[model samples]
Target chain A: MLFYDCSTAPNPRRARMFIAEKGVEVESRDISIAKGEQLQPAFRAVNSRATIPVLVTDEGTVLTENLGIAAYLEARFPEPPLMGRSADEKGLVLMWNAIAEQQGGAPVADALRNGHPAFKDRAIPGPANHAQIPELAQRGVARVAQFFDLLEERLNESPFIACDHFTLADISTFVFVDFARVIKMRVPEGNTATRAWYEAIKARPSAQI
Target chain B: MLFYDCSTAPNPRRARMFIAEKGVEVESRDISIAKGEQLQPAFRAVNSRATIPVLVTDEGTVLTENLGIAAYLEARFPEPPLMGRSADEKGLVLMWNAIAEQQGGAPVADALRNGHPAFKDRAIPGPANHAQIPELAQRGVARVAQFFDLLEERLNESPFIACDHFTLADISTFVFVDFARVIKMRVPEGNTATRAWYEAIKARPSAQI
Candidate 1:
């Protein structure tokens, strides 16, 4: 398998971390988003969407989305299952992961895309030209704070977002919480439970990759 | 099961349509977002994040995400097989559903939250106050276009987004495409395959409700 990767982006990072967690070895090829290489014709052939973190399977089938890559890997490497072992566990993993994506990661991304001067004409993803909106950044910052509070509350109830065991929920949430630093949002100082959980997940060997 | 729903929102509408598709009888309680009822202290007890489309199982476990609700319903009512039957089929359903969530549905939401004035101070989904960013709306519009093209391309290759069968991928994608109208974006006239697929899915009895 050939993994098309981007070091700076959060979504690609999630795939990379998941692969590491599964101890799966695949050839990695860096796709430089900072250099606008994703728009180049050569890269577009691999993925017309020109997004990073694409996995080309041994059969030459390109898995273009993060969840696609994760699902494929999870099914192949069922040990230390990141999705969940049972029906209910799978549902919980999907639930918490979606929450982390919608409530945490997305808000931070909106703030960056609309507020960052680097993305002045590229507020959205894909091969389109769009202007930025600075006001959304302010809103994103506020939303992120609430997301932190929500995470803290969830952590207070369970060791992991879904339950005592660390699953894909932990993977998604950990990436979002870490990515939140870009928007200048931190885990609240009073959120001891979340802080401890974050630290514990951070210490995982898979997290380092 | 009791469904905490909102009539006007796209996310909740996805759940409603899914339940309709399943032909399941669910008692739905409206949580009016326009009235700020979701943020009330009373509503927070049902869901701390205070978002709609929450499902309370007969066991009283609160399922807060769309995928969560879908998984619970699919398990209990397995005849229709909204997820999939085989391992490969399951992977495809999950992959397409996640793509619809991230690539299709999320951008429209970012556009709405950052662009809509009604969401002023409530740009985020939680109980906190945040402002809107007008620039994100432009980005969102562009992303929606790209999403359409992506969908068009995918539909051209297969009968559905994931596999040959109509699964949750179609359900989520159908909702996202329908919801895109709020952003003044519609299915492009040139996307014949996607248009045909959309019409077929729209004709389903579940889509009417």
Candidate 2:
């Protein structure tokens, strides 16, 4: 298997952390998002969507999205089961993962893409270019603030984002929370549970990648 | 098990179709999104996120997101498997499903929510009020057009969105393509492959719901 990664991107980092946790080795290559390498024709041939964190399976099937790559990895390497162990646990994992992506990741991307000068014409990712909207940048920041609150509440209930143990949900949430710094936000000083949870995940070997 | 539904919304419809396809019976109550019932305190008690198609499992666990609900049902039922039968197939299913969502559902929602007066101050979902951006509306329409082309290309390669047979990816893609009509878009006349695939999924009994 071959994995395409971007050292600076959050989505790829989630997959990277997952791979680290599974202790699986896949030939990996880095695509420089800062250099706009993903939009070039060579990478485009591999994934027409022009997104990073793609995994080409042994059979040559290209898995483009993070969810797809994670699903494949978890199924193929079931030992450390990052997704979940049971029916309800699986549901919770997916639920929290989606929440982290939608409520946390999406907003952080919006705040950065629409607010950053470097992303002036790249507010949305993919093959196409989208002009930034200042209003969206403002909304993104506000939503991210709310997302931190949501994480704090969830963490207060359980040690991890999804359940009692570390799972893919934690990986997703951890990445987004760390990435939130780009938007000049953090787990509030008062959100002790979320702050503690973030620190714990950061100490993991998988997180260092 | 109790299911909360909104007959008019596309997201809930995706879960509803999945349930119908699986031939699973769960007592369901309609939450009138049109009436802003999703935001009321009563429903808020069930799901603070103010989203619909929530499933309260037999164990009293609340599954809020569509993916979560689908994961729970797929695990419990495990027949006529919509997620896919193998590791590779599961990855492909999630990949295609996400493509349909980011490429199809999101843009459709963006166009309508930003352009339609009915969605004023409710551009983004979940217990929040966000002013719409006209630029996003324009970008969304353009993206939705590109999504049609993406679907056309994929349908030409495979009979179904993800694999040889119908699966969760088809459910997600079908709902989004149908919902695109709200933005005054349809499968283009020349895309025979996509038109045929859409027609086939539309003919399914689950779609009739």
Top candidate by TM-score: 2
Which residues of candidate 1, in runs, are more than 4 Å off? B23-25, B75-78, B85-89, B110-121
Please give, for residues A107-163, the per-residue lDDT of candidate 1 as tens digits.
Answer: 788788888877887766666666766766666676778788888878888889986
Pairs with steric clashes in candidate 2:
none
TM-score, cand. 2 = 0.99
Candidate 2 lDDT tens digits, A1-209: 99999999999999899889999999999999999999999999999899988999998889988889988888889989888788898999999888988899988998999999999889888888888988889989999999988988888789988878999999999999999999899889999999888899999999998
- Kindly report which residue pairs in candidate 1 clash with one another: A132-B135, A133-B135, A135-B133, A136-B133, B121-B130
B121-151 per-residue lDDT for model 1 (tens digits): 6656766666665665666777888889889
**lDDT on C-alpha atoms for all candidate structures:** 0.82, 0.91
